[model samples]
Target: TNLEKRELVELSTRGLSRKEKLIVILYYLEELTMKEIGLVLDLSESRVCQIHHRILFRLKETLERMREDLLG
Candidate 1:
């Protein structure tokens, strides 16, 4: 389970933009709060929230695709 989780995170960040990569690393790896991430990235907290949500949606899509590929 741990290995799978690490792989999932790696896969999630593999194709991200630089800013998106940073956000994921900060939020997941560094375990930072969204407000803290916003401060580090010089973005408003709400903006970080928006971007995080978007990132999550993209991840969901990616996961779905991977699941389909695996089940094929």
Candidate 2:
């Protein structure tokens, strides 16, 4: 398929710890705002943004590696 669904599934399965995974799911899949995530997690909005950024960057690297594996 051209959509590349497996890429996300592989990253979700292998790359993230429980908390980081939860954060990503809540933000992306659930479409929650950063402020809402902070409220749910009992953190500041800025803290939530920082965590989200860190998690996203880590996932980006993981997915890039997977893409390299697929390509090479």
Q: State the lDDT of candidate 1 residue by residue for 1-72, as single tens digits.
A: 767766767888877889888888888877899999999999999999999899999989988999999999
Judged by whole-model lDDT over C-alpha atoms, candidate 2 comes out at: 0.75
* CA RMSD of each candidate after superposition: 2.4, 4.0
Each candidate's lDDT (Cα)? Answer: 0.88, 0.75
The backbone clash count of each candidate, in order, is 0, 0
Off by over 4 Å in 2: 1-13
lDDT of 2 by residue, 1-72 (tens): 423544664456465676667677677667799899888888898998988788768878877998999999
Scored by Cα lDDT, where does model 1 land? 0.88
Worst 10 residues of 2 by lDDT: 1-10
TM-scores of the candidates are 0.81, 0.69
